[model samples]
Target chain A: MRGIFSDGPRTALTAFYWAFLLYLLLPLTLMMAMSFKDASFVAFPIGNWTLDWYGKVMQDKQFLDACLYSVMIAAASMVAATTLGTWIAMLIVAEGIRGRMIIFALACLPAVVPGMISAISLRIFISTIDMPTGTAAIILGHTVHAVPFVVVMALTRLRSMPGNLVDAARDLGADNVVAFFRVTLPYLGPALLGGMIFCVLLSIDDFVRTFFLGGYRPTLPMLIFAKVQGGMSPEINAMATIVLVVTAAVGLYAEYMTRRARTR
Target chain B: MEPVVQFDQINKSYGKHVAVDNLNLSIEGGKFVTLLGPSGCGKSTSLRMLGGFETPTSGRILLSGKDVTRVPPNKRNVNIVFQDYALFPHMNVAKNIAFGLELKGLDNQRIHRRVSELLELVQLQDYAHRLPAELSGGQRQRVALMRALAPDPDVLLLDEPLSALDAKLRQQMQIELKAIQEKTGKTFMFVTHDQEEALTMSDTIVVMNKGRIEQMGDPDTLYGRPGSVFVANFIGETNLLRSTVLGVEGDTASLNWNGITITANQGGLTPKPGEHLYVVLRPESIHCSVTEPATGNRIKGKIRQRVFKGNHTSLSVDVGDGTLLNALVHPSDVAQLSGEDIWVGWKAETSTVIPDRQAHN
Candidate 1:
């Protein structure tokens, strides 16, 4: 009875939880608040607020072009990574396939490698291969990094999937191709969606790899980095706050979808 | 007519361990044939082979007199109901049922008609729009059955489909499954380790042991006249009395048990004189009495123990010479037995004898 409802430990745990949440959100909250500051420079003080900075960031042609370019690259890399990752996951889960553990480890290596090390290595690789630094190179680098996340997520879901579903389909007169498309693909839908969204987020937030593999055209992260080099401004904060909110919403939706799939 | 399915001298071995060894069986069409054995005895393996999921190691499988040893599952005219009731989670009951029909290039109208008819047969018409996860266990099982039956394959394979249900629901499904089989008149190859399930639903039961067929017969024959000691022990509770055959007369053999000479049916075995054999005596066949009445074979023994089993009382009688025989008595008749000493008797025709094969193997 004493252990059931101990108020002393409960109070301590509640205080710790709130402290952790505050620590995590305080920086992001400050950045978002600064986006509404009326002053041209970013500072911590009680000042007048306006939406002029957001409007300016939204109207900047260079910022809009960088955002569009980053979106196109993310879209391309998401498709590539999802396809390759899902295939590798299926191969790992398939029966009679030897060296599956080795394959899975190799496929997931990129996710563990340091971002700077991977970026430097990719820069060297593109130079050695006589390929120029551009959108294609950036897409390739992003695909390599994002593939591991997709593989890990899809493999986890695939492991939980019942083996009999495919067998039942084949027994009901479906060929291997048809069975995979009709049964296996639909079963992997939620995991693939989550993985693809994660890939998009990973690509959009990546800077080290893009820094090493950029052409004349700048991406959103590169553009923001270039702008930050000048000085900290509410306009830059406004742009970052927009990216942050959109990415957070997308991440939440992915979590919601996969969680719903799991419950179903 | 040719057999619907035949395993011609099939052998399946995974490296050193043989899952199936030299199995030869022919299944008749429109009959409920069951492969009954313990797990790893190759009952499910045999059903999977017939379903074209597993290939035999050294022999051929013929379906309707056509060799299908190399045909894949999709090419074979067979469908299976998996134990887990592997219904498509993404599709509703009606869509799941129409999957096979759609693959077969059936028009939407025909597929829709077939799906509705199957749902109606299983009394799941209202559940046609529900997902597999939304249905009860019994309802999901019915959906799986209807899904496999949608295409109307030549044979239906059930790999312990009813094992997942609760005891009472399993019993109800057993009767429903038999009724469905009779109404469809389709060739069904079922596999189960539960002998009662095999006995209740199968027209022919194949008992397997150590990856080999021990016996295959109708339920009545397998129960009343089991060909082997394993079959006798596996099918139901039975007491084996080890004895030596004195002589064979007609279809009966005279066995010398302790000092009492008992005549028993030979059970298709012509044992030579002085041959060791076991008399398979079902507990229900032995009647317990206080007085040694005019009977065929009587053994005077003490009642070691009595267990009241609702309808009948099971008594363990200690016959002389370190022998304990079990007998079933009615509760009322058991109440009359006041003394520990009693006489247990059974007719000569009721007990069957099989030669002891333990030492030879």
Candidate 2:
């Protein structure tokens, strides 16, 4: 059994998989290397490694303020997206709402349609109403991209729920409200949590939408974009590496959670 | 006493296709009744309606003389043990059983006592701390049963609850379930496609076909004297031959089979002369012999095949024109057959007459 599980052919395939991983992570690896450069500019090879860039990043007030604004926007969007996504998923899947296929298609549009289109539309709408396009507008725009993921994940979990679990709960003297909390909510916890994590990851790194809607103040991603425009510096590389590391951790955890939930 | 559940003229339809058509049934309290049928025959639908998971398109359902047709499942007096158990995946066995009691807002001590008693009833006392996924299939089934029984609901509706188990475990649980039903004295409204399961556990068996009740009776009455061709075919293995009615004499009818006329009882049914008729004979009722039988409808035919069952040998004799007369002879008696050709016979009292006065699509 062990031989059949990971034979020579399978080991070869695993090698290929690691190669693909290397291809994906090569740019981030370069950025991490450049972050420790003693040189003023972010580039490849040589030079002495130092923490001076990290020191500069820590002391930059504007960059730190942008980081705070990005955190606020991402946190607010994560909460809103998770709540709406979970409830809307339940409404479509469990509530037996009519026209479900249409609703499902519509719910998935924000995810499938181009993010640039959504950003442009949201920016237009906000400016048309004379609303400020700084943190609030950026948060709204990011939610549009993040919510579709949450909705899809929650719906996937809810759809695979055993048919009679809710029925059994009700039969056991639980009303619909209690049944949801007792049976359905427990099954949905991992999926909803994964969805929230994805939302956080996407919101924190979101560049397209935040670029469009950041009126006077810049988010972390917008600040990184401005730094790149001014030519790559060690401080910019340091900040990018930090963001990359956090997002990668979140993304991996979310993947693991959703997969485990599915298997169970 | 009022019936525990009464479905009056219930009809359920999915789009244009009827699921349960004009179903009327009343289940007595403290009796184990099974709704047995083929797939898509509305047995599960009927059970669902009683459990309030399904609302009939028309008609009312009364629980203990109180109408509950439009009530949600939680408000109804019944609970269900689903086919796959439907045990809460997250909760341990004890918590699963206590859920209903918790919903009723019972004190913790009372809930624990009720859960413990239910576990004991299901003979799963040691499995209280195990989650549903941790237990085996039969153990999961017991936990599911205990969960439904915890609240002591008036009616316990089980929809093919033993279907997920292996054959041996299913048989074991059948006896266990019947014993539990008797001990609790709760109305057990079970639904299953397995006739043997229904016969083993039910005090009353309601056989359904094509979204309608074909026959409802005790196992003895249903197997010994099936009312219609559908019921006779569904309940057990039986030889059904379409025949031409020669005439009717009292409660018995004479039908012409493959070049012979046989008399069969109408089984308390009266039909018009110009109607379709069928002869229903259980395989065991037909006795095979090398020599001619002393009396009754005896036909000579050559043996086509022999199935050597452990307890008995089943032989099918071809009586010409594509008609095969099957007989289940005892293993000891099968040795006495002398040649390929033999006599297949049954008493007139054993043959059942299924008459259809109206044509059906």
Candidate 3:
């Protein structure tokens, strides 16, 4: 296995992989670097590094309020999405219900469809019903958008699990309900955890759906978009840097957990 | 003894294909019965139906005297050991065995005691803390058995439980399983595709073919008097010779081969003239001698090939009618006849005649 790296073509391929990774990370890296600039403007490769911009962002009341609102909405949306998604996945995989394929396809439809279409359609429907598009509306939109991903990930895990284990439990004198709680649920722990993490990240990072639904209360993404239109400020860069770092840390941790699970 | 479980007029079908048709069987309490068959012969399907994992399309199943046809598997007083063992990967040996007792709401002290007893019974007391993946194939099989038997079900169903082990281990486990079954005195219904496993382990064997029971009897009766040509061919090695029934006199029947006539045991069946039949002769039944025998049912043939098989020699002889017959002679008998014209003779009572069916293409 180590000998394969000695060849020129293999070396070139390895370099290409690194290059692709860097390309994907470039924008986030730049945003973080510019956040430390002494200058008031968000500029890359600044002459001086300072913490003044981060302090300014911390003190900004609008940014602080938006961050708080976004956190609450995202948390609420994730809890709703994960619960509903896990229920749907368990039913489809374990129960073998009629029209399961149609239901599964419908559950996953939101993931592949354009976010703008979903956002605008939700906006129109909510407006007709006179529902206020504030924190609650944005939370609802995020939940709708993030649920399909949770379902897909959880359902794949549930489907791949050996059904023989469940049957074995029943044969060992467990009723259907007891078997599901004792055997099936425990086996799904890691997958369900991973799905929950993914749902949280998705709900927090949503921009298009939140944009249409946020009428009075602004989420972090909407706040950042407004700052970008007002000529990129160093405060905006500082906030971006924090979001990027947190998301990257969570993403890496999730990846490590999933890889370890795969190896086992 | 009365049967502990009974399947009466059971029929199961999937779509248009019949998986098991009118399967009726009774398993006596504390007796070991084996359902033996080739693949797709419905042996596993029948066991699944009995385990309540499957329901018959039309029929009733009785446990002792109560009808349990519609009862779910978890409610039925039966347990199954799957071919793959199906041990809980996340749980250790002790937890796996205790799971059934825990489900029944047994006291913690009783569950622990029973689990320890089962662990000792399977001879894996030291491996109680080890996961299923850490154990060897045979050890996993034992653990699976302990898990199913821990509940003290009225019946135990083993589905090809030893098929996953190596040949040597399989043979060892066969004896261990028999010993365990005898010690527990629990009704056991094991299913296997291996003929030798069925013969060596079962008190009663039910041979199945194409979703139907071909024959069911003790090992000796199944081997000596198979009910059909299928049962005879499937049970053990036997040479079948095409012949026509000449007549039946008392307990023996005279049959005419291609160019010769011989007498065979009637076996309670009357044969008419011109009826094509098959004469089954075990290789060991035929005796080979250098000198042509003047008496008994004898045939002269030149030895075509002689292969040594450690304790015995297998001789194939051509008896002038383009038919090759095989005879098993011991090494001592081989010294008297080697690659020469010889006489083959068998007692009339040792051979069985069956109605000849269409030959396979």
Candidate 4:
């Protein structure tokens, strides 16, 4: 047993880790490589490579409009989700709150439920309420999907926070409203920022909900899906590559910001 | 002048358990008072009630002769240096100190001036720009103190603020805290479980037990003349010798021990003839000798154990019937008591008598 648990590296674990990494990166690498292919079709064994597909993707008015449209929806949903989620998180973590466990479970239910199921239910609910299917419906749907992530992140931060901070604020002559804005909200800054960014990323890539709720105007994912039905092309790969790079960069920046805030 | 703070028949109960029971206390201005007790002794609860953190079930709390029972904590002119310091992590030391002043609607210039002056109070002027997370423990403590003092509150409440520091730091902070109290001349209501800390810092100490005040007086009075067995044991190390009172003189009582007759002070307690009592004998008051001295109360016993405590040697002498009386002696006295038999003695004025309630049953 000591020999098996020795300080030396385990070859089997190393092999399995590399295999997992390769499996995860292989498809992403292919898609990126195909974006640079000169051929119009997205097939292997490309004879030539060029930047023409990227140039065309950049010039496409429909792609640009779709990008802007998706961003606006993500922003709207993020704002609503963050505000509502932070309030719910605070309610759950507060003292003398009855049935906290049940409240937390319900708050986090959207995150655990299947996206397809949530999308279908949201569609039916919106129709029942006589809400038109457009930016409002898509934002409503995205906000519901985004809320649980915000709640979970904000809840984790709130639990680790010392209760004394608020007490100290009150002792120093701050009323409830002032104390929340001055002390509690500032303390929850990093968590809320991370959660908002996560909401944006989640809303941007959410296909099922947008597909179900969207009307005439198509988002980036919807536009990409429409283009894919026509034919798989290097232009589509270029569009996907741009989105992948941008989202990955945003996610990384959020991670860096949270880490910096934590250390500070 | 009236008292700075007063608690009138306060009682705080949580569900079925009473935390503080009918507590009435008046704290004078410019005095450092400490509520000292073990955990669950209601010391903290009483302080919280005074600070407007906890409302009493039935009572009124007055601040400088104003009824503040229903007032919120922010409305009260009382500030607390919380046990954890509770400095805002996002705010710098200067900003943390300026928080209360800003809320008072002080202009930026005065707030800055006041914050810097407070920083100089703890000699942390250079650390004004530093965040709380960047500060050392003692520095953070000073910042917390300065923050509480910034608003010139009528009363300052400290809840075991020094308990988190190391031994040396705690001792240093104790002196600093007392000095700050003297300098500011603010009524300080400190709550702590450390008896030594209370004795060192408090102008007046209120000893609490079981949700009630056990005794309240100056430190010397509480230590030298404890009213009950709990106060006697809790304030300092002492041995309680169960005895029956044979006779009583003015301010003195003759007690009959297991087989020895001893005389002790009444300690303001009146007892009649044939009454059961316990004589509270401080260990430091007892002297150990090889032979019985010609004066004071003397008892013969065998030396059961000896512990060398650097400054003095602590001896546990078994005085028959399984009763071990502890006595502190000089290291030189231990060599002379090598024999089996030893005489432990203390003056009659040094020991006090208390009625043993179990005898009534």
Q: Estimate each model's TM-score.
A: 0.97, 0.88, 0.90, 0.96
| Model 3 CA deviation exceeding 4 Å by range | A1-19, A52-68, A94-98, B247-250, B270-276, B293-295, B305-313, B331-337, B355-361
TM-score of 2: 0.88
Real contacts retained, model 1: 0.88
lDDT of 3 by residue, B3-58 (tens): 89998999999999898989999888999999999999889998998888988999
Clash-forming residue pairs, model 1: none
Q: Tens-digit lDDT track for model 4 on A30-99?
A: 9999999988778889889899999999999999999999999999999999999999999998889999
TM-scores of chain B alone in all candidate structures, in the order given: 0.97, 0.95, 0.95, 0.97
Task: Answer with 2 or 3, whichever has the higher DockQ.
Answer: 2
Q: In candidate 1, what are the lDDT values of residues B1-361, reduced to their tens digit?
A: 7899999999999999999999999999999999999999998888888888898898999999999988999998899999999899999999999999999999999999999899999999899999899999999999999999889988899999999999999999999999999999999899999999999999999999989999999999999899888999999899988899899999889999886899899999998898899999999999889899696889899988888899998898999865899999987897788789999999989999976889467
DockQ, all models? 0.86, 0.66, 0.64, 0.84
CA deviation > 4 Å runs, candidate 2: A1-26, A39-45, A59-64, A94-99, A112-117, A215-217, A226-231, B241-266, B269-279, B295-299, B319-323, B352-361
What lDDT score is found at residue B61 in candidate 2? Answer: 93
lDDT of 2 by residue, B1-361 (tens): 8898998999999999999999999989999999999999999988898898889999999999999999999888788999888888888999998988898899999998888887877678898888788899988888888888888788998989888888999999999999989988889999999999989999999999989999899998899788887788888899887777777888778778766878777777664564567788999999998889999888889998999999998898998875887789898898887479899989878987776534454
Better of 1 and 2 by lDDT: 1
Residue-level error in angstroms, candidate 4, position B37: 1.2
On the 0 to 100 scale, the lDDT of residue B98 in model 2 is: 90
Model 1 residue A52 lDDT score? 94
